[model samples]
Target: MTGESLVYVAWAAQQMNARRDEFIAGLVLVTRSEIRSLDHDSRMVDLLNASITENVVAAIHFLEHGGVEADVEAPTAALVYARALAQRDVALSALIRAYRIGHGRFVDEAMALLAAQAPPEKALPAARELVHRAASWIDTICDRVGITYEQERDRWVSSRSGLRQHWVNELLSGSAVDIVKAEDALDYRLDRNHVAAIMWAEDTVATRDVGDLFDGARSALGEALAASGPSLMVPTDEREARLWWPADRIDCAGVQAALAEREVSVRIAVGDVGYGVDGFRRSLREAERVKVVALSGGPASGRVTCYEIVAPIALMAADVGDLRLFVQRTLGALASDDERSESLRDTLREFLARNGSFSATAKAMFLHRNTIQYRVAQAMDACGVSFDDPDAIASVQIALTACRWMGSSVLRQTNPTP
Candidate 1:
């Protein structure tokens, strides 16, 4: 570029700098209109406006006095805006789009100023130089700011997740805490009804990206549960994510339907509806207990385990060793791990559960009434239990349930099934 063209660029920069506010306002208006993602709320808008002003001023300054590409740095406001976007979980692509849009408008305004200030011949050359320099500045600034956004996003999420985990652990530990402080730190209300769930990916499918998998699961769960605003999602490990919804109750059927549609192999253990702080803690505790029982049966047993359905087994699971002895004593030979004994135990359990009704047990187990009666007799002979004693029947019933869930863990067999 000739000195005359440089002089023309300087004149154009001066003109832009004089009306910097108007120029920035126009640029912000156009960028916000074109890029909807950048317009989140009033605070975000303020950040965008400040970012635009800083970027515009830097570009004009560079136009007026040529500088090495390496010497140019992204303005503080731009970096702050990028970090803000990252903290909000907004994509970096949106930030870059805002810059590109503003760059074009900036160049157009500078070119118009140059054309009016310089002679016709000098205007063309000056405009060319202006566009080149503007492009270089944008490339440099975008690279720097993009890096900043990613770094900030990782750091912010890690810190935020860690803080949330800390608070959750404190709450779960049953320690005395200031309710207001806990709510502020967690950004979750403990005064509302809560339905908690523990989710984990199957080992086979867990090799995929952990963050993406959990994030997708969170969205799916939220939609299925009809959760409003932000729900508390804290990942306790790489494969497991624990979340709570401010809901009176969870729609288990809805969750099943959603998971079926996605076809994502995941197991979720949900707790019953609880209210206030006590409910929050109790719900999570129940979910955790449910998860332990659900995973004990293997990955393919059940996809969604509700605390309500498994409440008794979950409570008994607190002391597996004690429960095992109780099962052995109550059921005797009926708790054998062998195939025949296992079948009889299952039949007898159902028979007893249906109020000692042979037809009802047969219908439920899809077997003949005679078969149900025969199995019950054999099971009774092995265990030597009597129906005449109501307390004995209740104890037998509980043991059978423990056998059904705890499987070989509570069964009386030398080599139990895995």
Candidate 2:
């Protein structure tokens, strides 16, 4: 190309650089809309936007400077994004497609600038040089990012954590696999009595160091449970992990004390103890169910929830909305979110739990018999139920249980007074 053509090409590249924000926005918008998998979550979307910005900046630099034959170093953000996509199990083709689409758009924009700004003779030659350079840059960058993706994927799959997670998933899925081989690979037996716990941070809790949180929880659980054999931990994501101890019993109080002592920020949902491989799978499922209940109830559900305590509510956790509606419908004004209503419901629930014994309910609630009687009468009046009817009694009991475990979720959302 002539010096005049090179000058026009440089001007077009500079024009793109000047409109860098526009280019990056358009590219990210197109990529996100076209490749759904790439836009999985907020974190991924941020990564994608950063990666495109870096790539566009680098591509514009490449065009302005004549570095066609030299090695292309992909922007750090771009490489990091590629590795993240690989870790997330996104297809490499998706990454390559994003590159090609962006390249085409970049070349098209450059051609448009050359057409608008350059003389006719300069525009064609400059457009050709611009396209060639853009194509070369994409080819090199894609090759590097592609290699990065594959290498990360390989390393992630072959890593010890990865293999262990694989086996856990297989077991969780209830697929028939050789238990002996799975045990050998995991280095944790599936034949023993196990207590599984699903541990995760509350969204409100900032997890500065996931490794430390998980390690501390493990050590605390092992020491608290007094486990003789090895324990297993499999991370489900950056924020959550599954843990199991080879113990027939899990003292929920002890576990809570241990977590408090260590100041671990994660909440734990534990399963009832179960034996053998089937028990292993069962224990994990139970923990998962307990975790669901705990999450639905939020922090008010407490930091450590065990299947033994929350099993009744866990069964209904799959449809909390429906269950919430039921609680409100059954409890009536008693389900109102207020101190007075809550006190009434608590007294009535205890009264029923103690089999209509006002004295026992008073003993349990640390209130006098007259107070329990008055509150029970108030709650019964609010519920508009007759204890004489068995169905009303049953429904009231169930609603109270839902309220106790589900907390405010199953309670009526009453507006506060102005």
Candidate 3:
């Protein structure tokens, strides 16, 4: 290349270095759809960003140095990224397409820069050289990265835990695989009745100590379920674990007692007991659903919540907007956060629970009979419904339960009357 051509190539490289972020943003925008389909893991996303930035910088360096020898090794960042992506199981086609799209965009930018800095005759040849250089470098790096990806993928497939996790994930996703084969791979019986549970750290501060917390939870759970039968616990991440044991073997009371005795900060959600292969999958799904509700119910809901008990509230509150509306309509002014309203609501809950027996409610709440009657009457008046109507009573009961479980933060009036 002549001195003038070298100047144009150098200038193009300078332009890329100066606006590196803009170039990367543009490339990402164009390839966003492909990238989204790769994997949702946070680590994979970080690798994608780092890989793009590093590749662009390396390309600029190659161009500035007059297209180095073909024997140069692939960029260290690209090789590392390829291995990471393979371990994450991203499709090879998606990885290759990202490179193709990125290089095409880089070539367009280089051409534009050359046109802006040189006359037409000089610019056309310089643009051709830049395209050749960029395309050749991309092809060489893709070959190296692709080879690394395949090797890493094969290694992952042959690992013991990898095979176990793969079968577990397949089972959970309802794939039609031989149960016997899956059992053999997992080393856990799927033919027996199962009760699934999920244990997780509740907060970021607690998450930092999750490894110890998970170990403590595992030990506690193992001891609790020992009498029931064999059990299995798998770590889904640093802060979360999934566990299962034979439904017939689990001592619910024992598990609860053991969990209470644990010193670590953790939450456990247990599914209804289910039997056999279908039951195994179903129980895990139910446990996950119940876990979401447990977290939403706040800390006062306790460390362990059974699926059977929470299913009603969890299903009812799934559509948050509708749940809020139902609460507002059923409780009316009682849903407000005033002391009087809360007191009346509590009195009504106890009165209903005691089957509308004023004496029973008084005895249970340690209040005078006259005070119970007054509060019940006040609650009925505030609620704008007669407790004599069964439908009204049922509605009020549901509203109170929803309010208690969901907490005042969600049930509080959105628009307050002065």
User: Model 2: residues >4 Å from true position, as ranges?
Assistant: 1-155, 203-208
| Worst-scoring 10-residue span by lDDT in model 3 | 38-47
Q: Which residue pairs clash within candidate 2?
A: none
Q: Is candidate 1 or candidate 3 better by lDDT?
A: 1
| Model 3 clash tally, residue pairs | 1
Using TM-score as the measure, the top candidate is 2
Which model is ahead, 1 or 2, in terms of lDDT? Answer: 2
Clash count list over all predictions: 0, 0, 1
Name the Cα RMSD for model 1.
Answer: 21.1
Would you list the C-alpha lDDT of every candidate in the order shown?
Answer: 0.82, 0.84, 0.77
- Winner of 2 and 3 under lDDT: 2
Instruction: Give one digit per residue, the lDDT tens place, for model 1 in 78-121.
Output: 99888877765678998898888888888888898888778887
Report the error of model 1 at residue 100, Å: 59
Q: Which of 1 and 2 is the better model by TM-score?
A: 2
> If the candidates were sorted by their lDDT against the true structure, best first, what order would they fall in?
2, 1, 3
Candidate 1, residue 72: Cα displacement in angstroms equals 46
Candidate 1 achieves a global lDDT of: 0.82
Record all residue pairs in model 1 with backbone atoms less than 3 Å apart, i.e. clashing: none
lDDT of 2 at 314: 85
